[model samples]
Target: MSTPTAGQLALADRIAHGGPAPVAAISHVAAAAYTDPARWAAEKTALFDRLPQVIAPSALLPRPNTAVPHDGFGKPLLITRDADGRAHVFMNVCRHRGTRLVEGMEAQYAPRLVCPYHAWSYALDGKLVGLPRADSFPGLDKTSYGLVELPSRETSGLIWFAFATDADFTAASAVGPDFDAFGLGGLHLFRRHTHDVAANWKLIMDAFLESYHVQRLHAGTIGPFFKDGVTAADKIGPHQRSAVGRVAELAALPPGDWPALRAAVTFAYQLFPATVIVVSPDYVNLMVLMPRGHDRVLVEDFMLIPEAPATEKARDHWQHSWDLLDTGVFGGEDFRAATLGQQGLESGAIEWLTLGTLESGVRHFHEEIESRLNTG
Candidate 1:
């Protein structure tokens, strides 16, 4: 078995107990948090624009000179790996005319990108390499026309993009190095399920931050595996990790076999701003929430496993797992509730809603968002 990280150790202790202490009591959050248009715009600028956001798995660009184009957040962005085996991100636009360059996230092996607009091309490293009709434009220096490079890093098998090109945030500082415990770098994408949820991004996120609803909401699927309202949550800067213990299975083990507890619990990490990762015993499910409007969000669910299932039996196993997780927990229980909640809140029936002690993680997340918007 792989060695466990500090996070795993702390989680094991909490599983031995019932749960972690509640951080705060029941508190009321304004309804505008989900229905205000101006507040949504401010959140986009303060959170999405200023902070580093998880874009795609680093495995997407596996080989040198490979690239994937992403436009999830309304801006065309290119993520590529150079011949020298370094990762880079840049605005997917031609410097000459500002036309969009790449189209989709398809893998391409071209060493250079040619903009279809004016035949201008850029190297894999974002340097302007080919320009049609160079002499036609006098005193036009190619050195000053490279694609706009953004801050990017590959860590824990994921690619992160920060809009604040020069900021104090680092991947290690934000999520910590302990994520390697998941052996994420060794896993490959098994499948991806996308959903356009009819609710605010925060509302969708809040649904996953706590296991308080598992007993009542997910009782048919994941609820039976966990103890009700029992979770261990730890905040690592803006990022957070919460684990739900498996009561019967864990308690059945003898005290001497306690080290095996890692297999008896599920760990969830709230990677600041918009990504949520749930680490189960068999696989890891990553959710990326892109807020499209005040009451709309585009959610991408990436199912990762140790490797692509080679046999028919293995493939069937993973496929069944994905179906259950997608329909039962996320779509059926979580997003369904978020959509209904949005409808009620939009009706002006309530000015504010209260979160109880079991929902401390939700409260803390909202507090962080408010703090960033106020300070930024």
Candidate 2:
């Protein structure tokens, strides 16, 4: 494992000393923020569309000449790595007749993308390479007709893209060094599951931003493994990074031992806008929350491990971790709570939701959103 960052070590030092997690002033957010359609529309435009968004982990397209289709955010996108080992993002539609070029979510060894409708082909770098019946279209320039490319960057073992061509990606790049310390780019994709939750996207993101709900909401599943309401958090641009776990154990570990520290505490990251990375002792979970509407979200959950299983025992161990997180902890607890919260907020029983000091991360996340929406 890579060595821990100074920030991580500082958090551990605080935990060892029994220092209280930093607290924020009590705050409240309008209930309409989660229930109003207009607010949701504005957020999609200002945040999701304008800001750089995570496309997928770099491990998804593990090698050159590989491709995958992504529509999790409701926009058909194709992610590819060229033979020269460069990553690119383009509209999934074929330039000829606008037919969807790639159909599935799994990455494949695709040297070139071929349109199923008319056999029009495109290179991994989005160049239109071949087409049938060249005489049919005289003076047609293939170079000018390449797939529509989007602004994209591959950093810290992840792929990020933006809808706007002029979008600044500095905020997304800020989190790369920390992620690299966790070896995120070299991990293996163990499993992936999709959840269509009846809740706003922010609600789902709010769940990961704070550890206040981990003990109570997940009491039966993952609660016992974590300390009660003890967490340390800071921000990287609009992104929030938090740590929660056995404080005593973390405090006792020798300094600079990140692997041992990881085994004692769980690190969670809420990437700006709507992506989450949870680093557990043995594996990492990436959750991409795509807002479908004011009251709906599509969550793509991925579990990544250090390497492929080499034995049946290894496979069993990884399978157990996957089941505990994907099926029990997140699917059963976190998502269920988000959907339930949505139902209550929609009933008009309350005008605003009170946020306690422990939920400061959630409030900070909202403030970040408000800053962008008001300015944009």
Candidate 3:
């Protein structure tokens, strides 16, 4: 049995005492924060554009010469691994006419990035290598026409990209020790689901930051398995790690089993700017929130396991977990509520959304956003 970390031990102690995580105060944010176009624009400029975002798990591009195209935070991004196994990130557009590159090519490995428009080709490392009728455009400098590179870094099995080309990024340090402990890179991507929610991206984030709604909103699925409104919240820079205790199961464990105490809690790690990485006993669920508009967000859900299930029984178990998430808590309850919340906020039915002590995670998240928005 492995010893519990300071965080797990502290959380277990708090749960044993039946105390809620410490809170500052209840807070409120304007309802227009969900429906106002100007507010959303400000968020994009001040928050998303200026901060580093986890765009993908490093496992997604595990091999050399592999690439993935993304439109994250409204910016076209192309992430690739070169033949030498180095990661590269670029503006997913051709330098010639700004044509979107790698539109539908899906073989997982590309010898070269070929623009479908004029056949402007680039090497796996993003250097411009080919162009049709090269002599016709004598002034075209191949050296200067490479794909536009974006500031990106990979660490702890994740890829992070910032909109600014010279953005300062420290992926491992930003995520803290919790990231390394999760063995995130060791997890294999078992399945992925994409969702478009009809609510502000913040609303989507709010749903995962607290368990206050687990008893009320997720009563049918995950609620009964854990305590209600009882959680331990710890901050990692702008991020947080929140844990809810498993009352029934923990009580069943034998006394003096210190290591087993760690297994009796479920953790949700909020990766600042917009991702929630939830650690379960057997698997990990990474949820990314990207705003499509003021009242719309695109969510990408990735389910991961230590490895691909080898036995029929193992496969069945994972499949059932996927089904539960797809049909219950996430797809059914949370998103449905977010859409309804959007409709209400857009209809001018509320002045401000209120938060209580139990909902301190939601409050702190908004405070972080406000803090970043106020930064230069």
Ranking by lDDT: 2, 1, 3
What TM-score should be assigned to candidate 2?
Answer: 0.96
TM match of model 1 to true structure? 0.91
- Which regions of candidate 1 are displaced past 4 Å? 18-20, 133-140, 171-174, 227-229, 247-259
* Candidate 1 global lDDT: 0.82
Could you tally the backbone clashes for each prediction? 0, 0, 0
* Model 3: per-residue Cα lDDT at residue 109: 82
- In Å, residue 8's CA in model 2 sits off its true spot by 1.4
Cα lDDT, all candidates: 0.82, 0.88, 0.79
In the range 120-159, model 1's lDDT, one tens digit per residue, is 9888898899988889989988899999999877787888
- What is candidate 2's lDDT per residue for 49-106, written digit by digit as tens? 8888887888788789998888888889989999999999999999999999988887
TM-score of each candidate structure, all chains considered together: 0.91, 0.96, 0.89
lDDT score, residue 255, model 1?
A: 55
Candidate whose lDDT is highest: 2
Off by over 4 Å in 3: 1-5, 17-23, 105-107, 227-229, 247-262
Model 1 CA lDDT for position 322: 95
Q: Which candidate, 2 or 3, would have the higher TM-score against the true structure?
A: 2
